[model samples]
Target: MPSLVTPVLPSGRLNASAQPALPIDGDLLLRPWLASDAAAVARVFEDPTIQHWHLRKADSEDEARAWIEQWRRGWESETACHWAVADVGDDRVLGRVSLQSIIMVGGQAEISYWTTPESRGKGVCSRAVARVARWALEEVGFHRLELGHSTANVASCRIAEKTGFALEGIRRRALLHTDGWHDMYLHARLHEV
Candidate 1:
């Protein structure tokens, strides 16, 4: 039996011999970031609503380009996969769903995502997340996918609920915001595939 007081480890660590592969779904192909995506990424970050839901640097076109470069590097290094959620039939970038800060601790991977103003309430991000979650579980071999969000982000909470992530609990004052430290809701979805 386990004690309820024992805390779970963050998913950034894993023991030897428990290798988990990251998944790539060409069917849900991510187009390479373009120079044009700079403007789009900038627009996404301009949405104060979106920023309130994420932790990001001060916004600028140059920063957006730099962000894309880092995104490319992550892919090249096999560190993580980031998919630009676009208009589905066009090159216009709407937002992004990314496997950010992947921590393989204790046989799990912590996942995170975001969406732009134009794409909100349209289900683009949720569908993208579901596709990625399926791939992460069935293809990546990660035993768990962890999602964390501030309690104030109702939209993201909805996304987690819609995607079948169970609300585990809260990490009190886990993030530093513009005003002060904020509470974070920890959500988890064990590999069901």
Candidate 2:
């Protein structure tokens, strides 16, 4: 039986090629996570603030390495994509950006990110996210990108706005944190073409 609506993105659209490294201006790059980055990735999750917002930690370098492998699998499966935000000069890890919960049929995915403590307030997160958003919508042909964060995370809300993800509304008690249940602010951007 034929369906009435066409898939927003055809299957195999993403896994057809290897993921590419994306440049952010002259100073930053978004690249695939490498095994050597495991230690730094673990350290990033050790930050109290990161743990608070993300609700999980790497715990050990081995665990972080496992995460790196998982990211590779995500690319192969076309279910999600992750990138390490790195310094263009030396490729040192500065942060991470990802498209999660991808739905090729709907042309949608959720954006998630976090920055190293040293990179916070430096506009690294916003710049990287904006670059990824543009690539997803324009190059990858995704129709919509969504971002959601705890309402109490003012910094995250600012990032969403800066990256052109307009606030849609809030989800009541949508997520759980260490403290308790929290409301989440949802935002989204759509491809114009």
Best by TM-score: 2
Mind giving the per-residue lDDT tens digits that candidate 1 earns over 116-148?
676679777777788778866766566688889
Q: For candidate 2, lDDT tens digit of each residue in 22-141?
A: 998999999988999999999999999998998778879999999999997898898999999999998899999999999988999999999999999999999999999999999989
Model 2, C-alpha of 70: deviation from truth (Å): 0.6
Q: Each model's TM-score, in the order given?
A: 0.78, 0.98
- Give me the overall lDDT of model 2: 0.94
Among the numbered candidates, top lDDT falls to: 2
Kindly report the root-mean-square deviation of model 2 from the true structure over all alpha carbons: 0.9
State the lDDT at 60 in candidate 1.
Answer: 85
Clashes counted in candidate 1 amount to 8
